[model samples]
Target: MSRKPIIGKCRLCGEIKKLTFEHVPPETTFNNYSVRILSGEEVIKQVADPNNPPWDFSDTKGTIQQRGRGGYYLCGDCNSKTGQWYVPEYSKFVHIVHSALQEVKGKEFGALGIKMKGIKPLSIFKQIMTLFCDINEGMMGDNSLKDYLLNKTSTNFKRERYHLYMHIHSGSVERMNGIMVQFASGVGLITLSEISTYPVGFALYIDKPEAYNPEGVEITIFSQFNYDDEIELEIIIPKLESNIFFSGDYRTKEEIENAIQESKDN
Candidate 1:
């Protein structure tokens, strides 16, 4: 059966055009495999029932996406522009991180400062923002991203209003969260969106508070680099786990199981 046409507003350009499947991390960067897409209720049930077979679709509310983990969120024009201008460099960045991780697997370390060269930071950052826009539903207030994304060489993202962070992520779960707000005890009110998959995770905090210090290496500096500029830097990315549904919850599976056991014992 043919998939029905999905017509809606373009997340980036805000144009009402025929939308196309926009890959959040690009299919070339390890997002090509089939995965189960679950709702919040489904996720809670799956977590509670550890023996539930994730591969079994008969008794579940989740849908298995065979093409890849993405949706028809962007119009063809915006998708083409972002793919041509930004995705190449961003894909290279992801592969580089994955290579580094493979080279140092099973080592005891909190973080790794991977030295990367010839990286187009602006393009990578723009690609990251495009993913953020795709996962979100509505256009940003004031349409700031419109100007920043539509222009291929534009680097005028609203730095004061948005901050981006990144970490090395590994776990069974792949998260593509829309914009959500939550209050952390010491972190104040955090209004953020995140995309956590293998190799890397990103969080964009909107109108972040001054006192809010979030986990992960701040990569807002990527916005400052020129689109074509290539530079070398060592990024210290701490490995984090996405075993839970929460945006910033990086607890490992062992930690989670121990906590659950303790709760049952108590």
Candidate 2:
């Protein structure tokens, strides 16, 4: 018989805490079954093509794929608190989308003229996104995140921007699709290149710098593997000089490396 994963000290408080399942992308975004099975299958197909199997498959079949562990162990209190904290903020995010769709015009394209305009949802979303990014980066031991708003901060903003870009460009209602796919499939790692191709309809610059120089803004991605564990990926995005913008998805590892190489070349 197989032994169950053990619950020991809480990652946050270090108490002898009870273990419960936690979803990195938030379970409210997708059906549990779809996240576990269908998304798992998709990842398998991507990584384990029979014609070009670079890695051994026998050991991977029964075990959960590396990418599929977006959801993992958590204590009840942490889980409940995360839900309560993000739900209202997520709802506000939806409202911002609604307002943007209703009021934003073509002439406003590529212009940073769009303001938050007392939209509490956008403000709250920004704050929560910042917090989530900080926690994830802290877990990864990246000591570069000093300014949350001015510098390249967190992966959550990148993911959120990717979703918003998709909704605007593809006319698709699957705003949370990429995040759901990552969470369900255990593929928390993504690069800038992958997201750049995600059919974004608007221009987005997350924590992009205000001026252009040799040391352009650096964009980084991070994710929670288990409740306490996390990972990071970095990419450098140039400062945008024009206003015409379109949004898309986040990048995968390969894509991120490709972007970094391209930046070096430039």
Candidate 3:
């Protein structure tokens, strides 16, 4: 006999219902098919076998290069609502970003830069915000995010209060989809920050005017953006801390080079 469908509260509406697969970054962004996987244990053994000896894990560990996986996380109603209202604009935006990677005439940083046009900022913002919600609710198992979203509501969601940060990155076969939820207490208030990575990287968090910014990190500007304005995103090499790493992003310089070579072969 087939197992009974699990009853759960909707991430978008908070209504109890049967759950559905909710692709976190939306399915269209998963166009890249190049595959590459690696094992940390294998690398550790390889590095340790020569210098330290007896740290071998190659027998137990290996790399992973497989087709991307989708998240099965949502209720039927929310899945339908988001598909109707948000996915179209999000699909367009992802296409533009990926197209910039695939084709470019002559421009500085052509290989790793993008120039986007005819963007609907509100739509894209909502789409990205939705991704944050999906990760927080579906993956991280938090249900409180409906304050900013949910059907049949004109929420007093303050766009400016929440900040969006995008990190431009190149795709590799090893790239994955993931999120990191962090709580930081500073500036007199505890802030909940959610960072997500897949086709791109983004940080969704609260920021107040003239607040004590202890993080010292400069997030990108995305709220209240003009829908018709042209926007350009460029990639730059920077030193990063391991704690803040976006699991879905390119991990290392070697991984970056391998991804470039794989792209050329394809």
Best first by lDDT, ranked: 1, 3, 2
Q: Write the per-residue lDDT of candidate 3 for residues 186-247, one digit (tens) a residue.
A: 54543344433344545455554345442312333543454344465443322221111234
lDDT (C-alpha, whole model) for all candidates: 0.84, 0.33, 0.50
Error of 1 at 86 (Å): 0.1
Error of 2 at 161 (Å): 19
What tens-digit string does per-residue lDDT give for candidate 2 at 1-266?
Answer: 86586575433333467665554334332223332222445445644453432222333334343442234334566556545644454444434544554565444343222233333333233333433332232312223322332222232333433211212222211121222111112333231111211122222233222231112222222221122222231222221221111113323335544655686699
Q: Relative to the unseen true structure, what is the C-alpha lDDT of residue 209 in candidate 2, on a scale of 0 to 100?
A: 28
* Best prediction by lDDT: 1
lDDT of 1: 0.84
TM-score of 1: 0.90
**In every candidate, how many clashes are there?**
0, 16, 5
* TM-score for each of the candidates: 0.90, 0.36, 0.57
Each prediction's RMSD to truth? 2.8, 13.4, 9.0
